[model samples]
Target: MSKKIVIIPGDGIGQEITDSAVAVLKKVSDKYNLNLEFESHPAGGTAYDLCGTPLPQTTLEAAQNADAVLFGAVGGPKWDNVEPTLRPEKAVLGLRKGLGLYANLRPIKVADALVEYSPLKEEIVKGTDVLIVRELIGGIYFGDKCESEIYEGNERAWDLENYSVPEVNRIVEFAMQAAKKRKNKVTSVDKSNVLATSRLWRRT
Candidate 1:
């Protein structure tokens, strides 16, 4: 059976890169004799300009129905001053939240051909590869009761950082497994010496 892949050619350079990715996928499909179908959808600032909403219902429905979604980057200087709730960033966040994509995997790799891309010395950057398995949905980015307040000539603001045991455990298990697959070492970074949440994270 053909696999359905939903593509969102979002904003700015998205069109350029998305086309390249699609072409590569198509070539691979033809070469391997794999059944693959692609459905392109609009999202982000472009969608907002066309449909008056950053995340259109049609796009959301398509993504929900598709087997997998290939996304392009969103947002640009044109939509920089837009309202926070209606901004292009909101569209990406909404998709992640709606789809329940909790973990964020960022692979930092230094390519031999692109050695000059690194700010570090050639010797230090050579063959330096690392995987950052971040808990995307449960950190300060998604915390509740976050707001600023000012009253009586005094200003105060607080951003809550809360997490459940299950959330932490799941992320840790994933990170450990990822580390085991590579170096068999996991270096956990946190402000455990100061923050209460970090303490809890360490304890858990």
Candidate 2:
């Protein structure tokens, strides 16, 4: 069966990196005679500048129709002053919600051959392999965005942070399941010292 992928290159180096990655994918697809289609769409800060909305309907539709969507970076110092609702970073949250996709998993492994290149002591960097699983597209990233000029003659901006029980449980279950495939070990990290969200993470 043919595979469809939507590629969204948000801003900055995202375009360059995604372009090179897609080129390689095309090459490998040709070698294996795999039918693959890649469609690119604008997102993030650049999209807002072009169309006045971070997540355009056309872009979202393209992604929904594709088998997978590749994303590029968005948001930067240049867009720092944009309206909270229309901020470039909102594109990610919009896509995540619209696509019905959640959670992010990142794997880190220290190559045995590249051990000597480590900045840390050999002992610390030696067995540095871990899996990081995160709840995608929630919390502060999707919370209320605000910037205000208070009566004190100072500007303040803040994003809300929150986590639901279902969200926490789901992500934790996914992480533990992933761990079952490896060493049957998991080291969950959290800032339970302060934030209630972190505390929720701990409770789950």
Candidate 3:
């Protein structure tokens, strides 16, 4: 069966990189004789300019019905002043939330061919492959009370950082599975020395 892929050519470098990535995917599809169909759509700043909304209903409906979504980065200085809820970044966040893509897998490959890219010595970074599995939809980034408010003569803002056990467990499982496939090691990073939430994360 042909796989349906929805491509969102977001903003900025997104247009350049996504085009290259799609081209590579197409080559692989042809070589492997894999049935694939790609549908391109717009979101973020460009979409906002055209439709007055960063994420359009039509785009959302198509993504919801597609087998998978290939998303590029979103956000640019032009849309920087836009309201936080309507900003370009919000569109990317909205899609992640809408699709329930709660785990982010970041592969850090230190290849000899690109060792010059890093400041570290070739000996230190060479052949160093790491996968940074991050919890995408929880903790401080998606917390409530994340707004500024004026109190008395001074201005104070507070953001609540809360997480349930299930959330932690799910992320841990994802990390563990990824680690098991590679180095069989997992290193969790957080400010456990200070934040209570971090302490809970450490305990969990």
Candidate 4:
């Protein structure tokens, strides 16, 4: 069966980057004989501009039906004044919530050829290769955010951050699995000193 992928080339530089990504995807698919179908859709600020909604029903349906999604960047000053619910960033949250995607993986590898251009000392940056795993859906991004609350006679805004043990475990487990395939080292970073969620994250 051919795999269907929904590509949302969000806004600004996103369109340019996703275009290059599409070319790479098509090239790799051809070289590996991987049957694939890619469908492009507007999302984020672009979607809101065109359809008055960051995540339109048709885009949702296409994403839901696809085997995977290739998401470009989201959010820019252009949509800063938009309603909170319809913000460009909400498109990412919507997709993550709709698709039940929890963990996020980011890998960084410094090529030997580029090691000399290291911003840090060459010794400290040598052989710098790492994978950073993040738990997406259950973090501060999904928590309650508010504004116009009075605190001690001053107007204030607030945000909440939270994490469940299960959420932490899943991402950490993914990191562990990734470590097995790499150098068998996992460096988890958390600010247990300042956040309750970070404590739980560390324990997990």
Give, for candidate 4, the lowest lDDT window spanning 10 residues.
127-136
Name the TM-score of candidate 4. 0.87
For model 2, what is the C-alpha lDDT against the true structure?
A: 0.87
**Candidate 1 lDDT over residue span 63-173, tens digit each:** 988999999989999999887667887788778877878789999988899998878889999998899988877767667643458867888766678888888898899
Task: Evaluate model 3: give its TM-score.
Answer: 0.86
Candidate 1 residues lying further than 4 Å off, grouped into runs, are: 111-126, 145-148, 152-158
Better of 3 and 4 by TM-score: 4
TM-score of 2: 0.84
lDDT of 2 by residue, 1-204 (tens): 889989999999988889988999899999998888998899889999999999999999999999888887898899999987889888988998898677787889998789899898888898888988878867887777676656478788777998898888877888889999988887788899988999888877
Clashing pairs in 4: none
Instruction: Give the per-residue lDDT digits (tens) of candidate 3, residues 1-204.
Output: 899999999899998988998999999999998877999888999889988889988888889989988888788899989977788877877787777788999898876789888888888998988898888888866788645778898788887888888888899999998888887999999998998888888999
RMSD of each: 2.5, 2.5, 2.4, 2.2
lDDT of 1: 0.87
Question: In candidate 1, how many Å is residue 195 off?
Answer: 1.9
Q: What TM-score goes with each of the models? A: 0.85, 0.84, 0.86, 0.87
Between candidates 1 and 4, the TM-score winner: 4
